[model samples]
Target: MQRVIVRSSRGALPTAAKLVAGIGLALTGFFTASAILPYLPAGTRDQGAGLMSMSFGWLIGWRVIGRAPQATMAGAARVGLRAALWLALTVLLYLGALQMMARMLRGRYHGLSEALTDVIAQGLGLGAAAVQLDVIAMLFLGGVLSAILSAWAARRWQ
Candidate 1:
């Protein structure tokens, strides 16, 4: 009988670059939320939105941007853009899901399919309503800056 050896590969631990990127994006998320929160229709604004955005930004920064392959400044910028989009989409979906869950709790949605549909619809609506020049500019600038900083940190620390 032959014994076969199996080895599992664990990924590298998180680095300074990840931390820097996460912090950068987290601030970006918080500030962007702040920029738009005031404009939300009365009674519909949730005070926790900024915190939620920060959480999403940190997560995406650590998981998406941080895990991306190290590259040139331009490449880092691209990665940052992608990460930013992911963060935006994640926040949107979460907001939508929250709304759907609230409706479900209220017995507003009669079927699972309807609830799912509502989630998408709500997300689109939220995204549409949230679109503003300040928000876009902040996200774009923040993402690019964070990415560049991340790249620099990677090179500096590694």
Candidate 2:
């Protein structure tokens, strides 16, 4: 394989913007957890990944509504890609925090293989202290609806 160098021509993120985004993302997780966890079935309430749906909603809300709808096809596609990327970033941050909390609460985890197995099993066995897809699926749908409403609000008020 050949190696290639990559460089960013665009400037680094502004300090104030970085601070705001970090605080916003952190708050998103906290807000989502506080608001949604109690309503979830007891089995999957602790899994913070579910918070991504709420994060997605808030991120997409601004991205989708902030952009002008009259853009060219390519521009629209670019906006969509950015929206997807925002969701991915949100998921990573939220899950990373959750994993750290889990480790702190549970003490040291086992080897890599065991950790992976535990994650998979937790995903499969919500009734036994793990994540479940069904809950996430519903949460994601709720997020989409939330994004739409937020977009409407953004457009109407801003």
Candidate 2 lDDT score at position 26:
37
Position 98, candidate 1: lDDT: 72
Tens digits of per-residue lDDT for model 1 on 70-128? 57888888888888888778877877787777778889987999999999998787788
Report the lDDT of model 2 for residue 61: 38
Residue 110's lDDT in candidate 2:
53
Backbone clashes in candidate 2 total 0
TM-score of each: 0.86, 0.37
Cα RMSD of all models vs. native, in order, equals 2.6, 9.2
Worst 10 residues of 1 by lDDT: 38-47
lDDT of 2 by residue, 1-158 (tens): 99999886542322332233333333443454444354434434355454554555454534442333212444444443444345534544444445544654676665666665555444334322213454344334333333343334434544
Candidate 2: where are CA atoms >4 Å away?
A: 1-48, 109-158
Every candidate's lDDT:
0.81, 0.43
